[model samples]
Each structure stands twice: as structure tokens, then as C-alpha cells.
Target chain A: MTVNGVEQVRDIEPRLLLVHLLRDELRLTGTHWGCDTSNCGACTVWMDGLPVKSCTVLAVMADGRSVRTVEDLEGPFGLDQVQQSFMDCHGLQCGFCTPGMLMTARKLLDDNPDPTDTEIREAISGQICRCTGYRNIVAAIRHAADAEAAGRGDT
Target chain B: MQVPAFFEYQRATSVAHVVTLLERFGPEARIVAGGHSLIPMMKLRLAQPELLVDVNDLHELAGITVEDGVLRIGALTRHAELLASPLAGEHFPILHDAERVIADPVVRNRGTIGGSVCQADPSEDLSGVFTALRAVAVVRGVDGDRTVPMREFFHGPYETAVRPAEILVELRVPLQPGAGSAYVKVDRRVGDWAVAAAGAVVSLGPGGVVEQVGIGLTAVGDADFTAVEAEDLLRGRVADEYTFAAAGEAAATHCRPVADQRGPVDYKRHLAGELTVRALRDATARAHRGGSTE
Candidate 1:
């Protein structure tokens, strides 16, 4: 599978989950493993351009697909706008749910471009963030959306 | 960390290939699509299949199209895709209503409609939606293809009429002219399973008389997820709150619900009745407005 714009190959057991493959095999620790069930989206990653819980997906299922993790958020210019917005808005406390939030937020901004506060909350409803009470996280996503709109002269 | 037990995996290239694999692996083999439901069960050791036939690559079973006044939804159609289909929503708003609350967005992106129906969870939303629509399930096997009514699809919780060596290929919902459908669920949280839910499809005749009615109840142990007695009482009757309340009472009195984490038996029964009335009211209003809820 192509992960974070790089192709990776490994011989793994069929029982191995996609989250474990990324964290243990490829060492892409950016995708956190939480809630073995798909309820908690901390293990969320992009599979073929859509977010899915990696913990519920088998590594073998992604055999010929492409995966994008939170580690790939950086661009040549430096930290992605969403990463910068998180720092600006204090989106992290313990930082355990930051990666998943960032990944989901990046996708939301890319898709909706200027999502309303309600939209932002709905998009991240699958993910759990016990810290920061999600207010800062939602604000961070809103900040990123606002920044993108400003860059595109939509403001 | 939860991991599935050791199993052999094979990606099926085609429907024929999937049927062949299933026959070769026998009852011990299981076809997996999306893996959102099956994987969790496998992780908890609830389901232990010796061979996992991955059908994710089968493109033949992945689309929603209408043909001959029937909406044919491929078994591989994802929840997100179904929720986003304007054609589906325009024809049956009940599908959109159910899909919107089936699960969270990310999980919906990966979960398949076929998998959800095949899993046959007693609390599954789509099962109740399909039941209310009186949809048909298309099954493919070595002999050929056959269709089964949604009312007879589920044998029990976690068990479906889909026999081993057969794969459910598509679902066909016949379009009913001047018919409107709606589904209502009450969950503790945003993405939790239904405590008790109800779905209804109502078509009114001249003078606001009920022409046909189908009511489906979920998580309430209603036989086949249908309120047959309630439906019989509503058909040919005036579409009014009086009849609707009677149907609700019939449904509530007949259903057998057990107490659990979500609610006590009486509360669930009350929800079953109330949700049925609400679903019927909305459905009747939509029918009066000419079918499309949008």
C-alpha cells in the first residue's frame, strides 16, 4: 500500500489490523490506536481518500489501496494550515486525540472548505477527545477553515 | 488491542469467484465486505471463521440505480453512498432517515448496506427501513440467483436467510406510486444502536383513506421486525390520529422487548408505540404532499 505518498510493502498476518501495521510495521505512530472498536476515531486514516477507522480494518484489506496518515499533513512549505491552526488555537491538552482530530479536520476543510461550526462538530462526532472538552478542537478546525478561505480570497 | 484469530484470507475478483470460494470453503468460510461489523465480532471471538473471503474488490456489487420502477441497490453500497444518493433520497426519504443515524460518518464511509443487513443485528436500523419498504433481497449462488422478501430475510438475531455458499448481491425496492415512508429511532447517544425504533410506509387513497400501510419495529422483538396486526388495522381505514394511535397500541401490545442497558421493557414498549405513531404521521403527511420529503 502507498502510505503518506510512499509505497510500503511487508509480509504480515491476515489478522493484523491496519492500525497495527502502520504503528508497528511502518512505524507511523501518528495514527493512535484507541477503542479497539470503531467507536473512537483516534485510529482514523484516509483509505483511498476517505476517512475510516484503521483499528477495524485489516491490513490485508489495504493491500492495493492508498493510505494517508496524520504524519503526511506537513507540506514543503512547513506544517499544514490545520497543524498551524491547532497550535494557534490550543487544540491539544494531553495530545492523545490530536492526530486523529487533525487528520479529520484536514479532510473536512479539504471537502467543505468553509464548514459551519455545526458541520465541524458533526464531522468529528465519531472521534472522542476527553481533554480540552472539544471546544478548542472545534475552534482549531474553524480557524483552519477560515485561514483557507482567506487564502482563497473568499473572506 | 483486539485481533482476529488466525484465518486464511482471499480477495475475490468477481461474484462468480466469490461464490466458488464460498463453496470451496464451506460453512466455515465467511464473506467480508467493509469489515466494520464482522471485524469487531471476529476481534471479540464471537465469530470464528476459518477462511475470510474478502469481497471488497468486487465492483459488480457496488452501485445504486433504478430500473423498471425498482431501485436496485448493490449489496456493496456503503452507508455514506446511500445517504448521499439523491435518487434514493427522492424516492424513499426513509432510507436517508435511517442511513443518517446508522453510525458515525467515518464508520458509514466503510460500512456496506449488504454487510449491515447480512449481519442481521436485531437493533440494526436498515433492517427496519427495508422491512417497512417491503424490499426484496437478491441472492446469488452456484445454482443461480433468487430473490427473498425482506420480511423473511432474518431468521433470528445475527442470523439471516442467506445460506452458506450464497452471497447477497443486491436489494430491490419496488417503487410505490403516491407512497411516502419515514423511519424514527431513539438512541441514547448520536451513534448508538436503537433502543426501540419504528418505520412506516403509508399510501393514501381518495378522501385521505389508507390504501396500504407497512410498519416495521426494531429492537422490540416484533416478529420479522414487522407489525402485521397494526398494518392490518390501518389498511382501508381513514388516515387519522385515531387509527394511528390504535395501530401504535396494537404494535406496542404485541411486541416483546427485554430490559437492557438502553431502557427498561416498559420504556422500550412505549417508544415503540410513540415512534410508530410519529413515523406514521410523517409518512402520511409526506404522502399527502406527494411522496418526496425534500
Candidate 2:
């Protein structure tokens, strides 16, 4: 199966989780596994344009699906608007939940470009940021929105 | 978490293939759809089957349609499809309400309704709502097809009446006029499993008297329970606050709950009563063409 614009094929066990395949086989470790159980959203990734918990998904389940990881977010110059906005707005301190947080935010914004604070909170509720950087996260989303509205680069 | 090493995997392309596989494998094998529930249990090593037959690729096992005033949902219909289905939103309001709050959006997208009903988790929302709505499960085996009422289909926690070789093919819920139903659940988070929930289906006569009342409770027993006493008490009565409160009390009295990690048994009882009252109130209000907000 092709992942993150790369065509790849390999035989895998039925028990091999997609997170393991993305990390161990594919050498893409950006998707961290904070909770092997489905509770924690640390392994969130976009499969076929919808956000799903990677830890809960089997590698076989993703056989014919398009997967987008945090590694795919790197641009020609620097970090994407969502990532930079998280930094500028202080959305992270421990950064354990950063990749999943960023991926979830990307899907949320794609669906609703100008989401309300409640919408942002609901979008990221699956992920738990231990440092409780929610306040700054919200601010950064708003800042990114403002930048987009002003036709300036996203902070 | 690793799936136990004992099981063998077989991906079947059609329903006949699944049936043949199951018949050949016998009771040691289980059919897997979506893998939202089975895979998790396998990872935890809670359920160790010798063989797993993947039925997700069977196209005949997925889809949604309405026929003869009854909504027929294929067994593999995902929660997301139900949420997005116009038939569910139009004909089965109780199911729509429950499906809207199941797990989360991602889980909803992948978790199949059949998988959930077959899993028979007491805390699952759809099972309770389906029971209250008097839905039927269509099962297919070597002898052909049989329809099992939702109440009879669900035996207990993690248990169903489906035979070892039979495949659950579809869920059928009748569409009745003058029927208004609502499901109310309390959870720590919006999409978490219910601490306790109640699905109330109330249809009233022209004189504003209840014609039929079906109340199903979850997270309070081994399986979704029909509150027969509550239904008997509310029949032919005006669905007022007093009547609903009485019905709620009756339902709570019949509930056999236990304390789990979420909360104490007493708290579940209290929540069950509150949710029952709330669901009835909302259902009645909707029947009268009023919004639940009131």
C-alpha cells in the first residue's frame, strides 16, 4: 500500500497495527503511540480524508486507503500554518500530543476553515495535551484565522 | 497490545463465502466486520477465537433502504451512514439521536451497526434504542432466513441469540406515524460510552393519550432492557410531567444496575431515572411538533 505519497508493498501480520507499520516498516515515526489502546488520540492520522486513531486500525484495514501523516505536512520553506500557529499561540509545552493535535487541527480546519472556539475544542477533544495548552491552542487557531483573513502568511 | 497467536485470518468476498467459511470452521470461528470492537478485544486478549472470517468486503452486507414503511439497514451499515442517512433522520428519529452520539466521528465512520448489536455491549447506545423501537434482526443460515425481535435477539452482555453458523444480515425497524422517540444519555465526554441511557418511544392518540409506550434502558443491566412496568403504567395516560415522572420511577425500580469504574450503582440508578424522564419529555414534545429545547 502507498502511504504519504510513497508507493510501498510488504506482507504484514493481521495483528500489526497501522501505527506500527507507519513507524517501524515505513520509517515514519512522526505518528507517536502514547496510548496503545484507542483512548488516547496521540496516534491520530488522516485516512481517506477522515481522522482516525492509528493505534486502533489494523495495517490490513489500510490496504487500499490513502493515508496522510504528520511527515507529509513539511513544506518547501518551513512549518505549515497550523504547526506554526500552534507554536506562536503556545499550543504545546510537553509536545507529546503535538503530531496528533496538528493532524486533527488540519482536518477540522479543512472542514470548517473558520471554526469557533467550541468547534476547535470539540475537534481536538480526542487528544489530551498533558500541559493543558488548550487556551493557547484556541488563541493560535484564531490567530491563524485572522492571518488568513488578512491575506498574510499564517503565523 | 497484540492479537493472540492462535487465530487464523480469512477474507471472504461474498456472503455465501462467509457462510461457507463459518459452516466449515464451526463455533471456533467468528465473523469480523469493521473490527472496531472485535479487534480491540483481541488486542486485550479478552476474546480468543481460533479463526476470524473478514466479512467487510461483502458488498451485499452494506447499504440502507426503506421498503414497505420499514427501514432496512444492512448488517454492515456503519454508524456514520446512519447519521447521514435521510431514512434514519426521517423514519427512525430515536436511532438517529442515538447514532449521532456514538463513540466519536471516526469510530462512527468505521463501526458497523451489526458488529455493535452482535457484540451486545450493555453500554452501547444503538442496541437500547433499537430495542425500544421494536426493531428486528434478520439472520441467515443454512436453513435460510429468520427474523428475531431486537429484545429476543439480545440475550445478555456480550451475548446474542444468533447461532454459531448464522450470519446477521439486516436490521429492520418499522416506521409508524404518531410515534416520537428520543434517546438521552449521560457521559463524561460527548462521545464516550454512556454512564446510563434511556430510549423512550411514545406514540399518542388523537385525544393526547398514549397509544403505546416502549422504554429501553442501557448501562444498567447485562443487556438493553424493556421497561414493561413503565410501559404499562404510562399507557392511555397523558404524557405530562407527572406521568413521565411516574414512568421514570417505575423504570428505575425494575433496573438491575451495578457499580463499575465509571460510577456507583446508586448514581447509575439516579442517571437512569433522570434520562428516562428527559427522553420521554423530549419524545412527547417532538410528537407535538415542538422542539426538545422546551
Candidate 3:
């Protein structure tokens, strides 16, 4: 089975979570593992075209499904608009949670191109970013949403 | 956070195939609709089933329709769909309100109404709302199909009257015109489980008198409790301040809440009364008038 564009196959217990598989076996360190529990949303990723906590999903359950990480956020030069917004607005200070933040933000913008502040807050409320106090994170998302709505950048 | 070691898998193609597989697997098997609830429980090792019959792909259990003044919601219908549905949004606005505040968008996107009802979590918003609306759970078995009222379907905490071999195929709710409803829940966070919730449905007459009332309370007892006393107090009375206050007090008396991580039992009971009053007030206002602040 392939994960994040890499092809590999191995037999193991059904209990192995997709998070451990991505981190331990595949060595795709881009997908960071924050609280192993599903409460914290730092382990979020795109599974079969929906944003879900990878830590909560089993590797066998995600079989034959495409999984996307923050590594998929690059466009032409450096970072996607969402990530760039996060960097510009300083959405993260610790940087341990940037990947999950970017993926969740990407899905939110994809679903609602121009979401209100309340909508954006509700969308990312599942994720917990301890640094930057979430004010800048909300600002970054708003900037990206505006940029996307105005056709200014590749949001 | 690992899923249990056991579990054979079968991706069902249709409802018939799912029913056959369920019958074949018997008690050791469980159907996975949205998997939002079952999968999380499997990871916690609280439930270890030998077989998982995946009905996520069954097209039969995946639509909402209205016929004969009854709203028929398929079992596999996601909460996000319910939140976005125009029929549900317009007719059963309380269901829409309930779906809007249930968990975050991600959970709502995957969690299904059928899954929530079948899981029968007393703290769940849908269970209380459905029970208040008098929704019927349509079950399918080898013999035939049977309808179970939502009030009787949930026997206790984390328990349902559904049999191991029976599959919940659809939910039947009345689409009454003058009946206005609202689902109000108070939780620590916007998406967390409800500490105490209330779903109130009221039908008002031309003179602004209450014709009928249904109040269902969540997270207040072992199962979703219908405010029978409050309903009795509200029937045939004007939805004025005095009547509403009396009904609210009656409901507050009936709610039996327990203290846990959320708050103290006394606080929960207070919230039950506050939410009941607010939900009844909002539902009555909507029944009398058709404008929403949203």
C-alpha cells in the first residue's frame, strides 16, 4: 500500500494506527504526532478526501485510500497560500503544529472559500495550537480567505 | 490508541447484502455506517467485534425524503447533510440547529444521524431531539421491517432496544406545518458533548395559545427524558410569561442530572431548567412568528 505518494506494503496487527505507520515505518516525518488521543487535532490529515485525525484511524482502515499531509502544500515557489499566511501572521511560534494547522485550514478554505470569522473559528476549533494564542492563526486564515476570494493568490 | 486485533471486514454493496452479511455474522458482527462512533470506540477497546460489516457504500441508506407528511431520513445520512439539507432546514429547523452545534465540522461531516441514534448516547443531541419529535426508527430484519419510537428505542444509557440481527434502515419524523422546534445545548465547548441539552417542539394556535408541546432533555438522566409534566403544563395554555415560566419550572423539576467531569449535579440541573426555558421560549416565538435571527 502507498501512503503520501510512497508505495510500500507490510503485514502487521490490525491495531496499528495510521499515525504510527506514517511515522515509524514510512518515515514521513512531515505528519507530526501531537497528543496521541483524538481530542487534540494536531494529527489531522486528508484521508479519502476528508480531514480526519490520523491518530484516530487504523492503518488497515485507511487501506486503498489516498492520504495527504502538509508535505502536499507546496505550489510553485515555497509554501501554499494558507501556510504562507500562517507564516506571515505568525500563526505558530513552536512550529510543531504547523502541519496539521495547514491541512485543516486547506480543507476549510476548500469547503468555504470565504468563511466568516465565526465559521473559521468553528472550523479549526477541533485543533489546539498552544502557541500564538490563536489570534494570529485566525488572522492568517482570514487573510488567506480574502486572498482566495479576490483571486489574488493561489489559496 | 489502537484498534482491537480482531475484526474481519466485508464491504457491503447494497442493503440486501448488508442484511445478509449481518445475519451471517450474527452477534459477533456490527455494521459500520459512518464509523465515527464505532471506530473511536474500537480504538478505545471498549467494543471489540469480530466482524465489521461496512455499510458506508450502501446507496439505499443514504437519502432524505418527505412523503405523506413524514420526513424519511435514511440511516446512512451524515450529520453534515442534515445541517445543509434545505428540507430539514426549512421544516425541521430544530434538527438543523441540533446538527449545527454537534461536534465540529469534521465529525459532523462523517457522523451519521442513524449512527448517533443507534449508538444511543444519552449525552448526544440527536437522541433527545428525535425523542422529543416522536421520530420513529425503522428497523429491517430477516422477517420484515418494524418501526420503533425514539422514546422507547433507548432503554438506558448506551443501550438501545435494537436487536443484534436488526439493522436500523431509516428514521421517520412528522413534518407538521405549525409545529416549531429548537434544540438548545450547553457544553463546555461548542463541539464537545452536551452537559445538558433540551429539544422543544411547540404548536401554537391562532390566538397564540399552545396546542401541543414536546420537551426532551439530554444528559440529565440515564436516558433521554421527555418532560411529560412540562408538556401537560403547556397544553392548551397561552405561551405567555406565566405559562412559559410554569412549564419551565415543571421541566426543571423532572430533569435528573448527575455530576461528572462537566460540572456539578446541581449545576447541571440548573442548566436543564435554563435551557428548557430558553428552548421553549425560542420555539414558541418561532411558532408564532417565522423570522430567524440567523
Error of 2 at B207 (Å): 2.1
lDDT of 2 at B172: 93
- Per-residue CA lDDT of candidate 3, range B1-294, in tens? 455657787777877787788888888898886676777788678888888887777778989999999999999998878988888777778988798889877667677888998898879888889888889999988888988998889988778878888889999998768778998999997689999989899888878888878898989883656878888998999888788778778887887888899999888888888888888988887787652424
Candidate 2 stretches with Cα past 4 Å from truth are A76-78, A145-155, B1-6, B222-224, B290-294
> How accurate locally is residue A76 in candidate 3, as Cα lDDT from 0 to 100?
68
Worst 10 residues of 1 chain B by lDDT: B221-230
Question: Which has the higher DockQ value, candidate number 1 or candidate number 3?
Answer: 1
Q: TM-score for each prediction?
A: 0.99, 0.93, 0.93
Indicate whether candidate 1 or candidate 2 has the larger TM-score. 1
Q: Taking candidate 1, what TM-score does its chain B reach relative to the real chain B? A: 0.99
Error of 2 at B232 (Å): 1.5
So what's the TM-score on candidate 2?
0.93
> Sorted by lDDT, highest first, which candidate order results?
1, 2, 3
Tens-digit lDDT string for candidate 2 (B1-294): 454455778888877788888899998898888788988888888887888888867779899998998889999998878888876777657887898678876677678999998999989888888888899999998888899999898877888989999899999988777678899889888788899999988888877788887888988873556777888999999889999999989888888889988899889988888899999998888777632222
| Highest-TM-score candidate | 1
